[model samples]
Target: MTLIPRGFTLIEMVIVLVIIGVLAVFAMPDLSVAAIRGQIKESGPLLDVAKQGVVQGYGALGKFPANNIEAGIPEPTKMVGKYVTRVDVKDGAVNITWGNSVNGSIKDKVLTLRPAYVDGQPAVPITWVCAAAPVPKGMVLTGVDATDMLAKYVPLECQARAATAP
Candidate 1:
């Protein structure tokens, strides 16, 4: 009695593998960016909480915290679950270091924020300005890189740097 074959042929298996490989090659970059974006989203609320803390401190004490610790934020030595690795406050600026979950293009980037001072007060409520750099006089980060996740993910308060003169 002859038994009928029930398994795929070697060529069929090879074709399936090649198809999967091609699909993976195309899907990988998007998946990576999406994963990083998810992580960044998670950090957003936490950052807001920290910012609120600073505002609250200012309201109660009549000044921004001298540092993160004073603001009740602990300085991070490493990333906490694909989010911020560090939080720092100085000279009215808040700086956050990105975690490893971010893509290499912007991983470990330091985002700087400062409460906009309108008439010597921190705006009517609070308006944060995203500094392009760490310095107080740095330009705002705005529509800088269309492909840069860091620039894309930045909050609305920030503006991309202006194009340089040729």
Candidate 2:
């Protein structure tokens, strides 16, 4: 009795691999963009919370906390972990910077907020910075214009910086 081989042929395997490679090539860019967007989204609420804490601290102590580690800044004590590495009010604006300690690869993100002239008005436009890392591919970084991806999410305080020009 002759037994026939039951595995995929070499050509079939190569074709499958090529198909997968094509799919990955097509999907990688979108996946990376989505991941960046997701990271930004996840960071938003954390920033909001940190801003609220800063406002509260300002209200109580008559000033924003000296830094993230100072009392009253709400140092990510609960489920948020210690992602909030720094928080400080500088040059009439609050700056909140945070990052993951695990991988240490992603750039530390900064969110600057400036108090609006109108009470309860949204803090000026947000801005982002790559903090010791290169800007991700397909992502543009602008140190001035708010439309730039990195600059869009910067807090108002940082926006004020953009408003001023030498």
Candidate 3:
């Protein structure tokens, strides 16, 4: 009787490993961008806080706040989180600057969240437009856009919004 091998040959195993290595090389950049994207999200709570201040200011003053003090939030430079170095309220927009132990790829990048509301309607709810995201029809976009991060590093929703713009 003849005996046959029951397992993969050493040459075949090496070839499989080489294929895996090549695939990983292509995936590394996307995976790194995903990690940096997560780091950007770590500042969401901070952004939300700033948003509240802007909305409240609009509610009480019948208009959006022009700066942090008017919005009742801390100064931009004074605000700090694990990965966020600053959060600025600019003309009713929240501008978050990433840094302070964050990944080097995202350091010093700014992400803007501008409030959108129906023109001439103070009671209408405010919708936030991220980065350079498109605003809903009939809604007015407030504040200057300050987003400077790479598109791949922004949130998926932010990208989706931009993609749907006219």
Against the unseen true structure, what C-alpha lDDT does each candidate score?
A: 0.58, 0.45, 0.86
Question: What is candidate 1's lDDT per residue for 14-103, written digit by digit as tens?
Answer: 999999999999998777666655666577666675677667766666776776666666564532445677766664456677765566
Top candidate (lDDT): 3
Residue-level error in angstroms, candidate 2, position 105: 4.9
Give lDDT for model 2.
0.45
Return the TM-score for candidate 1, rounded to 2 decimals. 0.55
The predicted structure with the larger lDDT, 1 or 3, is 3
- Segments of candidate 2 deviating more than 4 angstroms: 1-13, 43-45, 54-82, 102-105, 119-166
Write candidate 2's Cα lDDT for 1-166 as tens digits.
9999999999999999999999999997666555554554455566555555545544565543555544244443341434445545442244545565412323465544443222232242222332222333333332221122354343333334322111
After aligning candidate 1 to the native by TM-score, how far in Å is the CA of 94 from where it should be? 1.6
The C-alpha TM-scores of every prediction are: 0.55, 0.43, 0.92
lDDT of 3 at 150: 85
Query: Of the pair 1 and 2, which is ahead by lDDT?
Result: 1
Off by over 4 Å in 1: 1-38, 120-123, 133-157, 160-166
- Reference-based lDDT, residue 93, model 1: 58
